[model samples]
Target: MAASVQRLQKCAVSPTGKHTASVIFLHGSGDTGQGLRAWVRDVITPELAFSHIRVIYPTAPARPYTPMRGALSTVWFDRLKISQDCPEHLESLDSMCSTLGAVIEEELKAGVPKHRMIIGGFSMGGAMALHLACRYHPDVAGVYALSSFLNKDSIAFQAVEQRVAAGQSVPELFQCHGTKDDLVLHQWGEETWSVLRKAGMAATFHSIPGLYHQLSRPEMELLRSWILAKLPPDGP
Candidate 1:
């Protein structure tokens, strides 16, 4: 057992002189916020240069990988196995959800409108991003998930159902999964897509051929395009 930890740090880039949109990047397992910052840099920053968008990268708390030996990493929640669920994992997911809610509230306090904020991540971070977008009240502008899995067994489903019954549309979602991903099966992504579609959520699923459990250049490009499309023309 290891001591519990908190793994969220924020960075801001307001180079255009006006606060436009804000992107919060969540990192995957075994990585820190700084490690995943480059992914956003290559595509997001350049595309939004004129729009003056700001980026925030948040780290996940360190935790031992339950199914693997001699491994520890920062994770939004634990994935015990490819198709297994655990109560502890659910609790951790709840904690991350609360943390994200606080982050959104803080962004509002900082003057960023709900529609101007996008939440995205890779792998485990991607899972967390999907969870947050589906469950967050008032919804977010968009959600991007790269090489990640949706928590089919989590409490997010109930939350989303409640929101839908109230006549609220699910937030826009852009998901990218590598067909060759071995860690999180490609089928998981497809199944998740099916569930979202059945629930009447607006979701776009992209299956990248010949890619693995990591993001490639083209995938990053797709993400950039999606983000741009979700942003307001003048700056949001």
Candidate 2:
């Protein structure tokens, strides 16, 4: 384990004695890690055995997001001045990449192999997860992006394309979006899914019709199962 990993004061749940896998989840803008914890407690069922795995709900650093005119927000990256589509602030995207990178690295140093770790998030956090999966942590088991689109102009996306061209492994991706999502239009998610799939990533996308910008029951179940599917058989 990395001796440098301490003071990771976020909402987390771990098996009482031992754990072999890790899941880091990022919350949407303006929402704290506690929000994700609530979802676990209130919505998630025990059948998933998530309690046996290490789950982390990391809160984003408070910063002035550019699209939000540098207003302080708990956001992974800055957005567009108007819509939730492409053309995210490049600088902010880099910062988010770095932040997520550190988290993945910490888990790696803690003896979790790249294939045993999963990174994901909701909304803006989900967007950041997709960026990291394509760019930073290609070896990660999979990525779960809920109602989040890809970051436009991501250097990681370009790099991953090059790697894939060289026949490298691409991270498995699971994405779902609400068709009625106005915050981040479902069309954008669909388009991103197509781009990634065509690029050779083992990707899946689901469109929840008539749903808004929120987590539905089916989506939650899908996320839980997706994580289980990506990892190796559980360890004792």
Per-prediction count of colliding residue pairs?
A: 1, 0
Which residue pairs come into collision in candidate 1? 7-59
Give the poorly placed runs of model 1, Cα more than 4 Å off.
1-7, 39-50, 69-72, 84-88, 233-236
lDDT tens digits by residue: candidate 2, 146-229? 887764445656767888999899788899999888844687677777777877888899888787988777788888888877
User: What TM-scores do the predictions have?
Assistant: 0.85, 0.86
**Compared to the true structure, candidate 1 yields what TM-score?**
0.85
Reference-based TM-score, model 2: 0.86
**Candidate 2: segments with Cα more than 4 A from true spot:** 1-9, 46-51, 82-86, 151-156
What would the per-residue lDDT of candidate 1 be over residues 41-117, giving only the tens digit for each residue? Answer: 66444532434567777777676777666377677777666462443367677777887777777778978888888
